[model samples]
Target: MDKMQRMEQLVEQLNQYNYHYYTLDQPLVSDKEYDLLYDELTALEAETGITLPDSPTGRVGGELLQGFKPHRHLAPLWSLDKAQNEEQLINWNNRVLRLIADYNSKNPDTPLPDPTYVVELKFDGLTLNLTYTDGKLVQASTRGNGVIGEGILAQVKTIKSVPLTIPFTAGTIEVQGEGIMNLSVLAKYNETAAEPLKNARNAAAGALRNLNPRTTAERKLNAYFYNVGYSDGIRFSSHQEMVAFLKENRFKVNPHVTYHDSFQEVIDVLHTIVDKRSSLDYLIDGAVIKITDMRTREVLGYTDKFPRWAVAFKFEAEETTTVLESVTWNVGRTGKITPLARVEPVELAGVTVQNCTLNNVGDIERKNLKFALGTRVFIRRSNDVIPEILGKVTEEQDGGEIVYPVNCPACGFPLEQRGAHLFCNNRLDCKPQIVSRITHFASRDAMDIETFSEKTAEQLHDELNVREPAELYTLTFEQLIKLERFGEKKANNLLKAIEESKGRDLASFLYALGIPNTGKSTTKVLADHFRDLDKIMNATVEELTELPDIGGIVAESIVSFFADPFMQAGIHKMLSLGVEAKPPQQAAPVTDSFFSGKTVVLTGTLHQLGRDEATARLEALGAKVTGSVSKKTDLVIAGEKAGSKLAKAQELGIPVIEDEDELIKLLNGQNE
Candidate 1:
């Protein structure tokens, strides 16, 4: 046979081998034999400069793709209501019952049958929506918004388990599933990876979202389809039927789906799943409970956000025990010493965690870990955040004592106890404190000096003697060029960047000051309220506390930060060096605008306008633009690819302006 014919034969053979091995978990051939055949096909394809459409080489990934195009889903990918506890689960069931009762009461002749539930593992990974036409996988996308998603067909094709073609010659269908990196796969990848991934969920999601399909293939992702969201000429009486359909079509459907005739039985199954959660190879954050009967699901219908017949029973954050091997104290920019606990590496939430935060020395004492080093401690990680030590596993104080340092770890300065924290008052002499302060001042949200990094900060502190933010303004190109790795171009670039940072806005300047217990939001509020540096520096704690989101502690921190003689000297020096803390331009008071008195939230990427500009415009119209969505939020302006914030807005029934045109119109006070 010719090369083309042989390539076709090999492609079909390799596809079957992949299906048997990856989907059915049964290898058809030895790895050596498979590789030989694959290599032959690869060589032939390269020789001819042509590859067939169904070639197995596609699974190896192709060239990089341009940015993802928005794929409008045929059917909306609905979010599920969550039940964090048994009480919440029971409440959800009651709501379903009430809805079903009301529906059956209206239709007496053909009343819906009593609800039965289907429980499936809720994989904690990226949501994938795949579209097929004429048995060919045409498109794959992320669950961006319920209505639209970013098309990622090349990334999805890299998954060996995702069938390129199916036996079902349907007109069109959209299948919904989760793309996940198995915990085992993640661990294996980390062994050889230069930069190890932190978590399987993030690894899978980041891979799929990567512009290069080669990166996605490197992750070796697996998918499990659960729901047939859209079908042209297909129907299922129950979710079980849908799963069977997915399985029949060679889609990898998870095998953990269970059916129960009663809600109480479903709850029992959930508890059983929770007990076995740690044993699973993949990450499952919860169990999804859906009404089994499709007709009943139709009768129950959906809320604005989620289906009334379905709820996700979310498991509590994973907790595991590990030995608290030792504790190391580190100094921050504010000179506060934080105790970091080194523990025996343990897997929690698909990540091997060896270090956990103890917050401060007081946290160590309060958690009874003062004498618990070398003993097992309970560490809980929630929402993929850094793990925290809950307490020791046992009441016995048999482990080694955790000694608190009397001096700063970095500078050997005498420490002072303030509240629960230890502080080093050495601002000028401490290397870590100075370096961190310089880094923070040049951070993107602050002065935004391009190419500035922690290493650069360290080099400046050690070599240039640039101990403070104001000192940065004094460095000449001649002095900078003498430093290690500093060429003439590099020195000039650094000087230019420093020159540009002198024009940073007042809010950014305030944040760069690194006030203790204060954040960017508070700084922005201060800049907006005071609009002048001298006014803010002289403002009393009572005046500061009158601002929104400013508590007594924050007020005191601001007041105290300005009160320091060193801080006063720094500000004066910065001003003398021509640093312009330019106040925002004043706008006319807007009391009668549509956004006036409204609590608004902006999320996702705005193609037409920048996020900061949108915020400024909203604020100028008297709108209180917050970072998160809540019941108090009167409106949400969601741009393209809006995620959880948009979902929350929908769940809370807060009105959302999704289109850029509509947002612009609203901003201009024009009628819809």
Candidate 2:
């Protein structure tokens, strides 16, 4: 075949392998083989006239910029008034309620629902704005001191969660989301470092500010959008309800959001979260307390800064404003595009600052920011990694209105919207999508086919027409002999890696699918509960939701997945290639016990084992766990300062037991 034909064939195959590995979780090739193929393709592309926009050659290593310039915003990115303690919170709550009461009392014609509040776990991370013009992602910016910040268009692209384009057919849309670290990123990064990370939030801020896009990818940072920035005539009644709308538009949102009828309900929700905060996966520094009515926010209006209708009660200092320099974009494992912001290096508490997250195209409109144009912006860097643009308008200046992209930079596809997201539909031909997917599929967690690397996949797919992972097992030594750096033994090793991936756990397979909302924990829950993929696919949303830890979102994703033709076809194809998932071994059914329906609270200290172990044992014994001491507690197992728990148990007059000795004996008794 001619050189042009060969190059086209190679690019297509590499991207397919990337998609399966990166986005979907299944990898079919060995790194060595993939690399050899990619190297050959690169050489050919250089020698021949054929060029592909999605070529693996483009995603090579690059250096960080010398420095960043800031863009001043049109509006000042003002800081919020914070409530630190219960008294402050109560005082604020009283004032808000009194305002509504007075407003309603004066205007007897209109009755209100007591002006309820929506309480959400204030994510301890950076804030961001993604501007979408004509429903396409264009530019991202930091909330410069609430006025101006740096521009990080290229750096923003590194974050996969931030969409490069909006999926809507409308002329414009903006989104707002919190850019934060993944659940376990810090722990993993710190495990090998000289000084392990102190917390996840810090790691997130540092990661987003990183100049290296590849490093940003490795951190696995994530973002969830919650508000609409600027839309032409977009309609929504309440901010709480808008969350649902954003999700419909394909934006990520906080899972712990709730509405309340009274301040007590709001307090109850807030306290409940604080009590069980440790159990939450993502880091949270405070609670975002807001009025449920949009009109109320407008009526309350803003002072020089902050919305009078809303207050952020910070729990622990996780998010603090810094300065921004720029924003960049990246196409993730899926065809979806993401945005990140780059900022001028500044110190928040201790760590140096630079960039944070703008989140996606929707953010730009919501934040209503101009380019940094060389000004300081307020960036909240959590724990020193995931930095997000929040406030920065120190002074007002005019920059051109930020616009979103209309076409995919990778495949040039018009973006398609799904709920709160914008996804590129040219998956079949998109180069970046394919490469990213392949990288993920071949990752150690998926297939454990360690021989495959992004470089290798690029080579094999683009140079050799190896479209799918399964094709890796089909390569011949004769093909290797024709490549640029031919060596038969290396080719053999690549073949060996493919052979080893045939038998992997069902959990890994599910994770590899790159199904939306399906992370490692959810994968384990679904796999362990169902025991097989067929059952998971056929199960109704209700059935899936019934499983503990398997939430409604995950169930919906599984259902929606089975509803797709291409995924089903891919599944059958994979199954035909001898790809199989092994179910986890389970223990024999244990005897019924008295703790079956009881809830237990273990506070302060436990002498027998750590908290996780104790919780595990309690769960194994069929007992539910509550973080706080309560009247409904069947028994309170207190150890030492168990302070509040001990006092609360006494107040309720519930029987309080101490130590594992008595608890074990009580369990043996089986009832009384």
TM for candidate 1 is 0.54
Q: Given candidate 2, what's the lDDT at residue 663?
A: 71
- Residue 579 of model 1, lDDT score: 97
Off by over 4 Å in 1: 1-285, 292-317, 589-594, 601-614, 620-622, 626-672
* Ten-residue stretch with the least lDDT total in model 2: 18-27
148-228 in candidate 2: lDDT tens per residue? 666554455555445443457576665656777755555466445543343466566665566665665556666767767
- Per-candidate TM vs. native? 0.54, 0.44
- Among all candidates shown, the one with the greatest lDDT: 1
Extract clashing residue pairs from model 1.
none
